[model samples]
Target: MSETTPQNPVFPHPAATLILLRDGPDGLEVLVMERHAGLRFAPGATVFPGGRLEAADHHPLWRAHWPEGEPPADLAHRVAALRECVEECGLLPTCAPLSSAVLADLRRGLAAGEGFAAALARVGVAPALDRMTVLARWITPEMLPRRFDTLFFLVMAPRGQEPVCDGGEAVGVLWATPRRLLAEEESGRRRLVFATRMTLLRLAGCADMAAALACAAVPGQGLPAPILPRLVETAAGPVFRIPAGCGFLPLETSAQTVRLG
Candidate 1:
C-alpha cells in the first residue's frame, strides 16, 4: 500500500446507482455515462447513473409522493438514485407524464440548490420510486482512499424521455447492451470499474427489459449481504477478490486493472 493510504478503512458514505434499462432494436440496453476524467472518483470510467446520497433524499416530505402503501425502508436510497439520475443525466422517472421543458427546469433548480422533493413539487410530478428494484449492494474495498456503500437499483427507462449528460460530472451518455459494453472494455474502447463490470455480467444474462426486471423481482434475489472485495498480494502483484457465495460470479483480478471509488 502507498504510504499515504490510510491504515484503517474509511467509513463508507451512502451512495446509490440507477441501472436504467430499455429494449432496443438490438436487445436489452442500459444507459451509461462517462465520468469526467478530472473527477476524483472513477475518472473517465463508463458507469450507470448514480452518486452519493443527500440528506434531502431522506426527508419525510417524500411520503406524499409514494403512489400507495408504505415506502420501502430503502426509500432514501431510491430517491437518491432518481435524484442523481436527473442530475447526472436529463432523465426522470415519474408517476405522471413529465415534459422536457419541466425536466430542464428541474435540472436548473437542482443546480441552484433545490431539493429533489421541492423540485418534484415545483413540477407537480412524483418520482416512480416503486418502479425501481434492488439489484445489488457493494461497499468499496477497504484499501481504497474513498469508499461508498452503494446500492444499485434497476429500473426501466421512462418512455419519451432521453438521457443527456450534464457535461460536468458526466461528459457523455449512451445506450448499449451489456455484452457490447463488456466487449468494448475488452477491446480497450472504454473503461469500466470492477463493480460495473460485475453488474453488467449479471445484466448480460437477461435477454430483454422484461427478463431483467423479472430477475430482479425474484424472492431474496438482491438482498444478499453487501459485497466487500478484499485486496491481497499475488505472485503477479496485488489483486482484488470477492468472497465466495456473494451471489455474483467469482471475481478475482489484478488490483491494477480494477478501479473502485
Candidate 2:
C-alpha cells in the first residue's frame, strides 16, 4: 500500500445519488450532469444528481410532506436525493401540479435556505417519494481524503418536465443510454468517476424504461452490502478490487485504473 493509504478507514459521511430515467427514441435513457471543472471532487466528470445528507433533512416537518413509508433509516437519503434532483436538474417529482412559476418560486425559496418541506408547501405539492427506486449503495475507498457512503436511487422522469442544468454545480447535461455513455468515455470524449462507471454498467442491462424499472424493483436486488473497494498493489500500479457477486456484474479488471476526474 502507498504511504498515504490509511491503516484504518475513517467513517464515511452519508450521501445519496439520483438516477433519472426516461424513454427516448432509441431506448432507456439516464440523465447525467457534468460537474463544474473547478469542483473539489469528481471535477469535470459526469455524475448523477446527489449530495450529502444534512441534519435538516431529518426534521420531522419533512415527514408530513413525504408520504411514501420508506424506512426511517432511508428517509433522509431519499429526501436528499429528491432535493438534489430538483436543485441540479430542475426536475421535481411531486403529487401536486407544478408550473414554471411554482418551480421558480421553489428555487428561490431553496436559495433562501428554506427547507424541502417549506418549498413544497409554497407550491402545494408533496414529494412523491415512491417514485424513487432504491438501486445500490457504494462507499468511497478509505484511501481518499473525503469519503462518502452513498445510496443510489432511480426514478422515472416526470412527463413534460424538462431537465435544465443550473450552470453552477452542473455545467452540462446529457440524456443517453448507459452503454453509449460507457462507449463515449472509452473513446476519450467524456470522463466518468468509478461510481458512475459501475452504475452505468448495472443500468446497461436494461433495454428500456419498463425493463429498467422492473429490474430495479426485483426483490432483494438492492439489499447487497455497500461496495467498499480494497486497494491492491500490482506491478503495473495500485488497483482497487471490488468484491464479486455483489448484485452487479463482477468487474474483472481493477477499478482504480478506470478513468476518473
Candidate 3:
C-alpha cells in the first residue's frame, strides 16, 4: 500500500503555492507563472508558482534550517513552493548574498538545471519555511483524474530580488492587478485553473499586500481541504458550488468547475 495519507490515502500528492506580491506601476500586483508545456499538470496555464514536494527536499539538514517552531511533516510542501518560484521565475530570497560568488554559484546551479533544492543544498541555505503562512488548503476532488493536497502560501517580494520569467518553464511573468488578470482570463488571453481564479478573486478583496500577507502570516482560523465537485450548467459551462456553511463565496460560471471553501 502507498504511504500517502493514512487517514485518506486516496489523495496522495501534497503541493504548495506562492502568492508573490509587490508594488507595480498601477498598484499592488501579484506575480503569476505561465506554466510550461512539459509539465504533467496545469501545462500552459497561468498559475501561482508552486509544485509537488520532492523526496530530496526533505533532507534532514535542510528541514533543520527552517525558521523557528517544529516544521510540519509537510516541509517538502514548503520546498516545493521555493523550488517552483525559482524554476518559474528568477527570484530568490537569499540573505544579502555574501559576495558575487553566492550569485555565481546560484546561477551556475540554475544553469545546470539544478532546481532550488539543489542550489540550496550547495549553499547550505535552507528555505525559511517559517516565513510561509498557509493561507488555504485544497484537495482535488476524486472526480478529477489527478488530486493534490495543496497548501497556498503568501510572501512579499524580498528586497533586492526582482521576478523574471524563466523563458523555459514560464513564458511570461508579470505583476498584475487581480481584476485585470480576471478580465484577461475572461477574454481568453490568459489561462487559469478554477482554483487560481477563485484565489485571485479572494485576494482581490484585500486592501494591500500587507493585509494579504497578514492573512497567511496567521494562517487563517484553520483549513480543511476543500473538495470541489463538478456540475454542468445550462447557460454557463460547468461550475462547482461550496457547501452551505463554507466561508468561500460561491461561484456559478460555465467556464470552469470549482468548489472552494
Error of 1 at 247 (Å): 2.4
Against the true structure, candidate 1 reaches a TM-score of 0.91
lDDT of model 3 at position 87: 68
Give the per-residue lDDT of model 1 (tens digit) for 1-261: 312234778899999999999999889999999999999998999999999988888999887777778777778888999999999999988887888999999999998998888888888877898889887789988777789999998998999898999999999999999999999999999999989999898889989999888776343423446888888766777778787866577467777877675
Largest TM-score belongs to which candidate? Answer: 1
User: For candidate 2, what is the TM-score?
Assistant: 0.90
List, in order, the clash count of every candidate structure.
0, 0, 1
- Please give the lDDT score for candidate 2: 0.80
The lDDT of each candidate is 0.86, 0.80, 0.67
TM-score of each: 0.91, 0.90, 0.78
Question: After TM-score superposition, what is the CA distance of residue 35 in candidate 3 from its true location, in Å?
Answer: 2.1
The global Cα lDDT (0 to 1) of model 3 is 0.67
Worst lDDT run of 10 residues, candidate 1, spans 216-225
Q: Candidate 2 at 113: error in angstroms?
A: 2.2
lDDT for each residue of candidate 3 in 211-231, tens digit (9 for 90 to 100): 677654344334555545344
- For model 1, give the RMSD to the true fold: 3.1
